[model samples]
Target: MINNVRRDLNDLPQSLRNYLGVALGGAGLVFWVIAVRESHFLNMNAYGLVSILGWPFFVGLALVAAAFTVELFRAPLRSMQLTILIVLLVLFVFGTPCAVEPVASLTSSWVHAGFIQYIVQHGHALNGYDARFSWPGGFSMGAVLVAFAGQANAIGFLRWFPLFIELSYLAPLLVIARSSGVSRRAGWLGVALFYSTNWIYQDYFSPQALNYLFFLVIIAAVFACWQPKPLASYGPQSGFWRPRLHQNRNLLTRSRWEGLDTTSTWTSAATLWVLGLIGIIMLASSMSHQLTPYVLILALGACLLTRRLGRPEMVLMITVLAFGWLSLGASDYWVGHLNVIFGSAFQVSSTIGSNVTGRLLGGLSHVLIVETRILLTGGLFLLAGVGFLRRSADSRALEVLAGVPFLVLIAQSYGGEGLQRVVLFGLPFTGLLAASAIFPLRTGAIKAILPAFSFGRFARFAKPTVRMAAFVVVLGFALATTVVRGGNDSYESFSKGEFDAVNFAYNHVRPGQTIESVNGYLPVGFRGIGSVSVTTPAQRSSTSVRRVGLRLLRDRPSEIILSQSQQLFGEEVSGYPVGWEASLESTLVNHGYIITAQWRTATVLALTG
Candidate 1:
C-alpha cells in the first residue's frame, strides 16, 4: 500500500488520484461500519466514542480525510464524486449501521414520520394540528416522495433520515465553501470541520433538516451568482440605508447600480434564471420551516449589507414571502399564540438560560457531554475570531456570513430552542472561517506564523506534513462530535419491544381516545396521528413527578404509556429521580388503572372507571 501510494504520489495521474481518493474513502467507510457493528446501541455513551468504534474506524477516517486533502491540494479540479463520498461517509459512518429497527435515538423522528403519514393519507395538511404541521411543506414533500416510491408511510425513512439530510447538505455546502474565497484546501477542510463539530441534533427527520438544505442551496446560489467581480467593489451605504422623507433619488439609484456590465444578453438571462431559482427556493423554505426563513432573510440582509448580494429587493421579497405566509397561510399557528411568537423577541439571556442552562440536568457523563458541547462551540467562535485577525482570504464574505446568524437571536426564541438552531445555521460559515485559522490558504500567512521555516527547497516536503497535521486536528473534532452528538442514546434510544407495545395500544384504542405519556420521548403516534391523539400529562418544566402522577390519575386518560426512554426522558429533561416512572406506575395501579399489555421495554395501561 505504501509502495502504491508512493507510485501514485510520484506519477500523479489525475484519474488514478481520483480513483485512489474514492477507494481510500470507501475503505474508511468499511472500517467504520466494521468497528461500529461490534457494539450495541445500549452500551453507547460519550466515552464509547473513543472505545466502542475502536482504532480501526478512526484510522480509516484519518486515511479518508488525508486522501481527500491530498487530492484537493494536488488536482484542484471539479469533482462531485469525491465530495459525495466524503459526505456520505461523514454522515452515515455512525448513523447507517446504528439506525436499527424501533425508530429510536431521537423520539422526534417518529413524530415527523407521523406528520408525513398524515399528509400522505389525507389530501391536505391538518389545520390546527400543531405549529410544525402548520408549516407542512417538508412533510407534504415527504408524503409525495413516499407515495412516489410506493411506500405506505415514512416510518422506514426515519432511522437514516438524519444521515440522508446531512449528506444532501454537502453539495450546496461545497459550492458555498468553494466560492467563499478560501483556497481549495481550506474549502475541503472547512467542509470537514462543519461535519465534525456538528453536535446540534437538528438533522433528525424533521422540517428543519429539509429546510436547512433549501437554506444552503439558496445561499450557495447567491454566492455563485452575485460575487464581486475582480477589482469591482461597492459600498454598503447604498444598500444599508435611504433617506425616507427627503427625495434621495441619487442614493436609491446608486444602490441599484451594482457596478457590473449586464449588457450581454447571456449574462442578463442567466442572472434572471439564478434569481428566479433562488426565489422559488426561498418560497419553498418559507413554507417548509419557520425559523429558517427568518434566518435566511437575515442572512440575505447581511449579504446585502456587505454588498455581496446585488438585488436589495431580493431581501425585501424574501421578508414579504416569509411574513406573508405566516399571516395568511399559517394564521392558525399564531392567531391564539401571539405571545409565543413575540414573547422572546428581546429576551436573549432568558432564551439562552432556558435552552442551554435548563438542559444541564442529567447524569455526570451527560453533564460532561453538555460541557464539552459548550467548549466546542466556544472554541469554534474563538477560532473564527482568530481567522478574522489572520485574514487568510482576500474577501471578508465569510466573516460577514458568520456574524449574520447572531442577529437571528433578536428575532425570536423559536420556543426557547432558537439558540440551538442558531448554532446549526451558523456552523457552516463558522467552520469555514475556523478552517482558515488553522489551514490558511495563503502560503505567506503560514510563513508569517512559522517565521524560522525556510520557504525554498524544504517547502514541498513541509507542506504535506502540515496538511496531514491539519487532517489530524479535523479528525479529533469529528471524533469528539461522534461522542457527544448522540451521547444521550443510552436512555434516549428506544427498543423494538417499545414500538410493539405502542403499536398494540394504538391498535386497541379508538380514534379521539387520548393516550397519555409523561414525556414524548417514546416512539409512538407516528402511524396514528389522525386516528389517535397523544398528550404529555406532565409539564416539561415541572420537577415534581408526584404532581405529574396526580395529574394523570385525576385526568384518568383513556390509555397510558410507560417506556424505558420515557423514564430516562423524565429524569433527564425534568430532573426527575431515577425510577420516577415506576413510582408513578405504582400510583396508577393503586388508582384502578389495569395493565392491559406489557412488553420488555414498555407497558400500556387502561383506565378502568
Candidate 2:
C-alpha cells in the first residue's frame, strides 16, 4: 500500500517533490542506516570538543544544503541573484564554527588572490618556479581570494564564506546541467556526489575548495565560445541577433521520448554567446602565460575527443596548441637536447624519464598502479566508459562525460606540469569520475528517467519502525568504521587531540619564544608564529635533528616533543608509509629534550636547563 502511494506522489511538481527530497535527505542525515549500539552518552567529552571542527563542518554543509534547496525551487537562471541572497542568509544564521583552520595554513586569498603573493610568499612565479616563466603580468585571482579570506577571518565571516564559495560551483553547474535536459534532481545529485567524493578531499575540505568551486565557471566561458553560431529556435525573425545567454537552453532543454527540433536563429545566437564568452576566456588563458591556458589546452583536447567541441573549437584548439608548443621549456635546453639528436628541429623537453617527465613522474609512482592494479582500476573506468558509449543517449554528452576521466589520466601521466597542476588535473578528474558513476548506479534510461519515489502510496512518509530500522543500519556501519580505524571520530580530518596540540603550543609559547618539534610539525603548528627549523626529509637522521634543533633554537627548545605519538597515534602522515607508530623514536632520546607527560602514544617534552 505504501509503495503504491509513493508511485502516486512521484508526479508532483518539482518544487513540491524537491521539498520532499530535502526533508527525506535531512532525515537521512539524522537517522542514517549505519550507526547504532552505543548510547548517546558514551562520549561526553567529545560533545564538548565538537567546537574543534565536526559540527561546524556538518552545519556549514547543512547550510549548503539549504542553499541548494533554494536553487531547486527557482526554475532556470531567472532569479539567480535573489536565490544567492537566500543562500547567504542560511549560512550566517546556522554555520559559524569553521573559522578555526585558517590560522594554520595562512589561508588568506590576497596572495593566492594576486601577483603579490606569487612574488613574495612564492618567488618562482616571476621566473617560473614550476615552469620557466617570467612575471605574472596577468591577474592573480587566487591571491585575491586569499586576501578576502584573511579579511573574512578578521571580521568573523567564516560561516558564510564556505557557503558562498561552494555555491560558486553549484550555480553554474545548475545552469548548464538543467539547460541540457538532465533532470534537476540528477544535476544536484551529480554536484553533491562528485564534490563530496573522497577524491575531492584536497579541494572541498581545504581552503582551495574555493578555487574548485569557481574554476568551472571560468572554464565554461571557453565552452560557450566554442558553440556553433546561433540559429533560430522559435520563428523566422527569432533566429537573428540573439545573445548567447539563452543558447545553452538549446542543448539542455528537457525532452520527452521524441528528439529535439533543431536550429533556431535567436536561440542559437544566445547559446553561442555563452559559448563565445567561454572561448574568450580560453583565448585569454592562452595569452596570459599562466596556468589557465594549459588547462584550456588539455581541456579542449578532451572536449574535442568527447564531441563537446563545437565550431569555434577548431580555431581555439589550433591557436592554443601552437602557442604552447612555442613556449614549452627554455630555448637553450630544448635546442641543445634536440640538436644532439635530430639537428635541432626535433625540440623535446629536458626531462628525467623519457616519456614521463622526471620531476612530474616522481609523484606518479605514489599514485600509479602497476600493470595489475592499473588493469583493474583503469579497466573499470574503461568498461564504464564502454557502457556509457553503448547508451543511445546524446553521443556528445556521453563522449564529453567519458572524456573527463581520460583527461585525468593524461594529466596524471604527462601534463601535471604547472603550478596549477592540481587544479588543472585533479579537479576535473575527480568531478568527472564521480559524475560518471551516476550513470552506472541507476542504470537504464527508463529508470534514470524516473524521479526518486519515497513519498508513495498509503505510507507516503516512512513508518517509525521503518525509519528506526534504517537508522540503526546506518548508525551501525558508521560505528563499525570508526571502531576499525581505532575510534578516530573524523573519517575526513585529523582528530581533536591532534588539533589541540597546535593551540597548546601557540598560546603556551610567548611571542618571539622559539620552539621546535624534532618531527617536522612546523607547517601545521607554527602558522602565524615566528619560528625556524632545518627539518628536511633526507637529513632527518637522529643526530642531525637534535643538532639542527639545538642550533636553530639557539641552545635547547624551551618546549619540544621528545615523543609525541607519531602525528596521529597510528595513522599515516602525508607521504610516509607507516602510521604514527613508525615515527622516529631513537632521535628524540638522543636529544636533550626530556619527556614530560606520556598520554597514550603522546609524550610531551620540555628541555632541561
Candidate 3:
C-alpha cells in the first residue's frame, strides 16, 4: 500500500509541482498578515539564473525545496509552513520582480520633501561636500545611509526586503505571541499572515516602517506584568534594558540573567555603544533634520522613566544630541536660519493644534485612524489581553491610543519626519493586535473554534540560526525592491534641472570669464575653475559666500549671472544700468551663462551663453 501511494505521488505533473511551490509561498505571505510575521522555509536558490537578479524569488524556491526534502538546511518546516513558503515565491515572480536605480530615486524624494530643490539640481558630491553647489546624493555618511538603507535602502540585500528592520521587530513579537497562549501551530500561522498583509509597505518607506518595528519589540516588554515573561514561561530577560513600561514590576530578577551575564562580555558594551552612535548618526542624517521637539521630550522622558537606560543610554542620547546639532550647523538651510520655521510655528501654534485635535477625535470615532500610515503600517502586535479577558482571544487590533501624541504634533510641523515618524513608531503592534483578531471575534463564525485566551507557555521554537537566516532573506528582498522602484520613477523627475544645467555649463564656461550672480549655490559656495565665481544673494551681495554680484557691481567683471530665488543685483553694468535687462545681458556676457533648457518638474533651466 505504501509503495502504491508513493508511485501515485510521483505521477504529479511538473506544472503542478511548480504551482504547488508558488501556491504554498503565497499562503505563507497571507499567514504573515494573520500574525504580522514570516515563519517558514523556501529553497531560496531553487531557480538557477533568475537567482542572480531576483533573489527573493530564489529564496522562496529554496524554502520550498527544503520543505520537500525534510532536511534542515536552516530548519525543517512543518507541512503548513511549507504551504505558505511556496505562495511567496509565486508572488515575487508574478508581482514584484521589476526594479529601478538609486540616485534618481533619492533626488526625486528630496525635491518632493521640499529640500534643496534648486541646489541639488546643479550639485554633485565631491568627498564630503559638493564642489558644484549641492550634492543631493553624495557618498558622505548622510548620502551613504540614504543611498544604502535610510528610507530608500540602496545597500545590497538588506534593503531588498527590509530584513534588519523586520527581523528585529518580528522576532520579539513572535516570542511574545507564543508565550501568550498562541499554540505552536496557531502562533506560526499568525506570523505568516502578519508578513503577507501589513508589513509589505516597508519596501517603500524605510525609516517610518523600520522605527515602528523597533518600537513594537520594546512594547512587548510591557506584557511581562507578572513573572514568566508573559505570565509563566520563565528565564532571564532579553535586550539591553529589562524595560518595563511606565508602571510594570521587575518580573525578571537580575539573578535570572546569570547565564546571560557570562555571555555579556565587556566587548558587548563597547560594541553596543559604538553601534548606537552609528545608528543615531544615520537616523539624524537621513531623517532628523527639523529636530522635532518630541525628540527632546522623549529623551528626557526615557531618562527618567526606564531603568534599562543606564549610563550607556545617557551616553547615547548625549551623542545623538551633540552630533545632530553639528549636522545642523554644517547645512546651508539651518545655519542661523531656524528662526524662520519656529517663528512661523509660534505664530499659528494654536490653530494648528486645534485642527490636529479634531482629526484625532474623528479617528477615535471611526477606528480607522491609521488609514494612510501608522494605522496603515504593516507589522503590529495585538495584546493577548483581550483574549485573556474573554477566556478566548481572537485577532490583534490597533491601539488607537498611541495616535494621540502623533495627532498633537501636527500643529507644530506637518508631514514626514516631524511627528508622523515618531507616531509611526507604534505601528508594529498591528501584528499583535492582528493575532487577537484571528483567534476569536465573538461576532465572527470563525471565532467558535479559535479561543480568545489560550494561556500557552512561552517556547523558543526557532533557534538563533533559523532566525538569522530568515532575517537575511526577508531584508534582502525588501532592499532590492526599494532600490529598483525608487530609481525608475523618482530620479529623473528630481534632477531634470541639474542634469541639463551641467551639460550647458560645461559648454559655456570660458577660460577667463568673470561671473557675477544674484544667488549663490546650495550647500553653498563654489571656487573658480576657469570662471571667477561671485557668490551672493538678493540685494546684499558680497564677493565671498555672502553676496553673489555685489563685488562685481562695484568693479567691472567681464560677465554677470542671475538665478531664481534671490534678487537680480547686477542692475548697473558696464554698458548700462543693472536693471533686469542689463542684469540679464551683463550676466550672459560676463559669466557666459544663459538659459539653455527648462523643465516643468524642476526649476533647472540649463544656462550657457
Measured by TM-score, how close is model 3 to the native structure?
0.40
Best by TM-score: 1
CA lDDT of 529 in candidate 1? 80
What tens digits encode model 1's per-residue C-alpha lDDT throughout 286-386? 88888888888888876655445777777888899999999988898989778878877888888778778977866677688888888888888888776
Write the residue-wise lDDT of candidate 2 on 75-140 in tens digits: 552344334432332222212212222212221221223234443355334442222232132324
Clashes of each: 0, 65, 109
Model 3: per-residue lDDT, tens digit, 1-609? 534543564577755654554454454444433322221211112121122334434454444333322211213335444434523432442233222121122222221222222222323332222221222322233334444453432223321333334445556555544543344333443454344333233332233343344334333432221112122223555543342121133324452222111122235566466446544543443343333323323432332232222233333454565455445433554455655344445434553444343333221212132232233232232232333233232211123323334543533554323443443433333333444443333442112333333424523332333333333433333333323322222111122233344334434555564433344321111123223343333433223322333444454443333322122112211112324443443544465444444432212222342
CA deviation > 4 Å runs, candidate 1:
1-23, 44-56, 69-85, 92-104, 230-253, 256-266, 392-394, 442-465, 572-575
How many backbone overlaps does candidate 1 show? 0
Q: Which lDDT values do the candidates have, in the order given?
A: 0.72, 0.36, 0.34
Task: Give the residue spans of candidate 2 off by over 4 A.
Answer: 1-19, 25-164, 179-188, 196-198, 204-215, 218-295, 302-307, 311-390, 404-534, 538-566, 569-590, 594-609
Of the pair 2 and 3, which is ahead by lDDT? 2
